[model samples]
Target: MITFYDFICPPPQATKSGNTWKTRLSLNYKGLPYKTEIIEYAEIAQLYKKNGIPPAIVFPNGYAHHTLPVIKDDITGHDVFVVDSLEIAKYLDKTYPDSPRLIPDVEDVDAQIQEFQNQLNGAVIAALPVMFKASVPHISENSQAFYKAARVRDLNFIFPDKPISSLDDLQFTPEEIHATWASLEQGFDGLSERFGGKNTFRWALGDHITYADLILAGLLLCVKAVHGEDSPQWQGFMTWSDGKWKTFLDNLGPYLSEDN
Candidate 1:
C-alpha cells in the first residue's frame, strides 16, 4: 500500500494544491489504491522528519521525499517518485497505457497541447512569492528555502519582502487591500490574455482536455478563492469560456463555487 503524506493548509479540502490535485486525478484515473498521512505544516518536522510534504510517498522503509503523484508498488516493493504535474501525467500514461490518456501521442497534436499546460502551470506559479510568503509563519526554513529557490526567476530575485509580508499580516486598510487586489488582478489578467482568452485557448493549447485542463481547473479554484466572488478582480475571467470544465464535472463541477 502507498502512504501519501499530505499537508492541511490552504485548506486542502477547500482548494487542493496542484500537486495533490494532480495526484488525485491520476490515482482516480488509474484506479490506484492508497492510504494518506495528513499533517499540518508546523508538524511536518514531527510527522515524518522536516522534509515531509504531501504528495510525497512514504515507503515501507519509512523514507519520505518530496514527490507528487508518488506511487508505492506493494506487490514489488518498489517506490516511485514523480515530481512535476506534467511529468506525473506522462508517467501514468507510460506506466498504465490502458488508462485514459491525458495527452495524445502525435507530436504535432502534443506540441500545441503542451503550450497550454505550460501557461496554466507557469502563469499560476508566477505569484509563488505571495503563497510561499504567506506560508512562512507556518512552515519550516527548509520549506521556505525550497520554495524560494524553486520560484527564483533570476539570480537577484529576493522574495518575502516587507511589502509581501504585510499582506500576510492581514492588517491592510481598504486602500492597501485595493492596491494588493489590483496587482493580483493585473497578474491574473496577464495570465488570462496568455492562457484564457477566446484565442487564448480552451485547454492551454487546443480544444481537447489534457494536462492543461487539470492544471487550469486546479489553479482557477485558487484564484477564485483569493479574489472574493463579489470582487471584480476576475469577474470576466471566472468561467471557462466554453464551459468545458463545467461540462466535464457536470454535477460535481470543477470549481469550488462562489459560495465556498
Candidate 2:
C-alpha cells in the first residue's frame, strides 16, 4: 500500500492540491491502493524534510519549500519515499511494471509532454494567484499567512512594479484580479493550440490519457477545489475559458480517482 501526502483543506477531504493531484491522477490511473495523509500549509517544509525527501534539484513554483504529492510505500521489502509529482508518477510506473503508464512508450511523447507541462506551469503564473485569493476560505486560518507569503514570493508580487515584502503588503484589487484572469485565459488559449483543435482528440497528445492530460487535469481540479465549483467566480472562469476547462473535465472523467 502507498501513503500519499496532500494538503487538508476546508470541508474535510473536499479539496486536494494540484501538485498532489497530479500524483494522485497517476496513482489512481494505475489503480494503486493508496491512502492520503493531509498536511497543513505552514508545516510543509518541516514535514517534507522529516520524511527525508530532499529538496528539488531545481526549485519549482507554488511550493513553500518542499513540494507535496509524495508517496511512501514498501515495494522493495523496506519502506521508501518518492517526492515530486512527475518523479512520483515515473517511480510508480517503474516499480509497478504491469500498471498502465502515464507516459506512453511512444517516440517524442515524453519530450512533448514535458514541454507542454512546462508551458502550462509558466502560464499559471498569471491566474494562479487570482484563483488562490478566491479560494482562501478553504485554507486553515493559521496556515493562511504562510500560504500568502509563499505565494507572493513565488508570484514575485500580486502585481508587477509593486513591491510586496510580506502577506500584509499584498494587494489584489479588481483591476489586478481581472488582469490575472486575462492572463489565465490567454494561457489556456496558447495551450489549446497544441491540441490541434478541440475536436482533434479527447486527450492532449493522442487517444490515451498521458502525463500531459494528468498535468492539465490536476490543475483544473486545483482551481475547482479552491474557487468552489459552484461559486460565481468558478462559473465566471468557465465562461471566460469558453467552456474549454469544463470540456477538459468531461474528457478526464474516465481516468479520475473515485473520490475525485
Candidate 3:
C-alpha cells in the first residue's frame, strides 16, 4: 500500500502546504489505495533521521527520498518519489496516460504550462510571508522582526522570540490589511484578464485543468484561510473573469473528492 506522510499545522484547508490534502488529490486521481501518516512539521527532523518518510517510498526493493506524494509500487518494487506538486501531476500524467490529464499537450502547451508554473510559484512565494504572518494570532516583536527583515540576512534588533499567539495581532494593522487586500484585489483582477474569467470552463489557460489550476487552488485556499470566505477582499475576486475561476473548480472537484 502507498503511504503519505505529511505536516500537521497545515496551511489553509485543501492548500498545497497541506501535504496530506495535496497527496490525497493525486492519489484519488490515480485511484490508488493509500494510507496517511500525519505528523507535526516539527517531527520531520526525527522522521527524516529514521528514513521512514512516505515520500521516500520504501518498497520491497529499496527506499526513496523523503519527499511528499511518494508512491511505492509494491509489485515491481518501484518507489516513485515526486516532490513538486506539478511534477507529481506530470508523473501521474505519464504513468496513467489516460482519463484525467493534468497537463495540456506537450508540443502545443509546454510554453503556457511553464509560464503558469513560473507565475504561480513567483507570485505565491512573494505573497506568502505576508499571508502567513497575517494569519497568526498574536504577533510578537520577534515575529515582526522576522517578517520585516525576512528578505534581509538579519534584523538589527532582537526580542525574546516566541510563537505567535493570536490571529488578531498579525503584523498588519487594520489599515495595512485593507490596503494590502486592495492591492491583491487589483492584482488578481488583472491576473483574471490574462488567464480568462473565473469559472469560465477555461482553466488558467484555455479549457481543462492543469498545473495552473492546482497551484491557484492552493494559493486561493491560503488567501481564503487568512481572510474569511465572506471577506469583502475575496468576494469580487473569486468569480470575476465571467465566473471562469469557479468553473475550473467545478470541473476539478472530483480530483479532490473529499475536499469539495
How far off is residue 62 in model 2, in Å? 18
Give model 2 RMSD, 1 decimal: 3.3
Worst 10 residues of 3 by lDDT: 151-160
Winner by lDDT between candidate 2 and candidate 1: 2
User: Tens-digit lDDT track for model 2 on 45-107?
Assistant: 787678676765444544436667678998778879887887887888888989988878879
Tens digits of per-residue lDDT, candidate 1, 1-260, equal: 64555545443244334455655555555555557655554454454333333534454656454433343334346665445566667777787777677767767766665666665545444355554444344334435454443334211234334333233333446676456545544555555554445443434444554565666565554454445446565464444444333333442253323221
Root mean square deviation (Cα) for candidate 3: 8.0
Candidates by TM-score, descending order: 2, 3, 1
lDDT of 3 by residue, 122-181 (tens): 444434445655544222333344323332211111122533433234465687766666
Query: Residue pairs in steric clash, candidate 1?
Result: 5-54, 116-204
Per-model TM against the reference: 0.57, 0.85, 0.66
* Clash tally for model 3: 18
Clashing pairs in 2: none
Residue 147 lDDT, candidate 3, scale 0-100:
29
Error of 1 at 115 (Å): 3.4
